[model samples]
Target: MTVDRLGYLGFDASDVDAWSRYANNTLGMMTAAKGKDSDRYRLDSRAWRLAVHRGEADDISYAGFEAADAAAFNSTAERLRQMGYQVTNEPDDLKADRGVIDLVSVIDPSGVRIEVYYGATELFEVPFVSPVGVSSFVTGEQGFGHIVLATPDLEKSMEFYVAGLGMELSDIIDWDLGPGGKHKLHFFNCNRRHHSLALLPAPAPKHIHHFMIESASLDDVGRAIDRMERDSRILLTFGRHTNDHMYSFYGITPSGFAVEFGCGPRDVDRSWSVVRYDSISMWGHKFISPE
Candidate 1:
């Protein structure tokens, strides 16, 4: 089960128009209509890296994990079946919709829909030009970026992702929330971009805590901060994480989940040793009130 990278993400939002504005005007992503009710966003050469469909869920609908090739994809599906999980070979309609050659769908312990696929549609001829002049996003081998999920059962979630999907544990953050007690967040990496997925034991209205998008330039982050502030969408102030050391800020997406826009995250290398950190961020990340 060699999952190469976190490829693409899909969300169900109540207001697709609001999401379109957020992705285009604020996040600086290029967008294309998936159909009548869905819109897909592009971060790089890939046809689409993120999508929002008109729905009331207002949460992550599915997460697509890329396999290195067709062999790896088949191996992963077989491995999941051997592990007693029901893996479904998705239909051609879905394959065409996702712009992938083939894909298999499975449910994690936390009930998050996971899609593993290969041969994603690439558009190298149509160079990515950010709508708001973001310069470029940190994608390519690292894929679209990271996703933080709030799981009811953290241990089972870990087993499904780490053991089942073959993701390597990067580090853990033991955050103390005073009256809220201690919360442990587990980070896992499938590539060099630190953790592509993180799990936190908590109860939330939504399945996702947030999904991150990294920019190639630190200046892009600065400009994003300005836009978020102007629109009163800042959820968490600027900060540097203890583990990945990503210089970022959390902004409220139109769907109600947070989106971390950042730059300059330290990579995970062979020398990386897993360690527990007492805090989530070294500096800021203060909670901002919409009041």
Candidate 2:
């Protein structure tokens, strides 16, 4: 049994103040709680979608992928064990922290921590309203959105996500990054969303490249571009991806990793056929701010 959509992403963040502002003002995500050390951001009705922990690395902590239910979670965990992965069930407190009924943990071949779970606790009793006025986020069964990871061993990482997790190949991109050279981006999807996970294993940095959060309206994306323009941490200018057709821009978060904000990416279904591309974007994702 394969996992569902991308559930949530955690981070080892350095500056809570900067992230608090970036999440609220730039990305327009609602703040659940902000402390001196830890901060929680909410995009939808979920208790929290992104969690920032006090750390020095300023990298990904772990990415949570949801399972359909208890049976599916168990099946996926068992499959991992059978495939020689040392999977372990998380304790009650850890599950409580994640707002999930239960979870199983495993590290992928690329050393990325993964949490597979079911029954996420929703904040339905309390409606979600962004503290900073902005349009809603596109999340539900599709999960908190997609993440792309960079690794030195692409084959192993690809096997882990595909043969191991059973995600479908959405498309492949051979990006000609000019002076930076070339790399292959393999897009995978578990649900209707174009891609919940993408793999890039070359000149690999042991961190998540970026995560995409689809806005409910095109105007919301435009508003965010304005914020990025003033913020100075903007990484890539506004652009549309060729495969997913995601019109978005990338900005470095307080944690030093980029976050993609955009809208109107096409979805997939049973009849979808995978294809490869020469370019990652149709146009405009040029480098905007200093890296």
Give the top-scoring candidate (TM-score).
Answer: 1
Cα error, candidate 2, residue 146 (Å) = 0.9
lDDT of each: 0.91, 0.85
Error of 1 at 252 (Å): 0.4
The pairs that clash in candidate 1 are none
Worst 10 residues of 1 by lDDT: 31-40
Clashing pairs in 2: none
Listed in order, each prediction's TM-score against the native is: 0.97, 0.95
- The true-versus-predicted C-alpha distance at residue 25 of model 2, in Å, is 1.6
Report the C-alpha displacement of residue 159, candidate 1, in angstroms: 1.1
Error of 2 at 141 (Å): 1.3
Candidate 2 deviant stretches above 4 angstroms: 33-37, 289-291
Question: What is the lDDT for 245 in model 1?
Answer: 91
Residue 139 lDDT, candidate 2, scale 0-100: 93
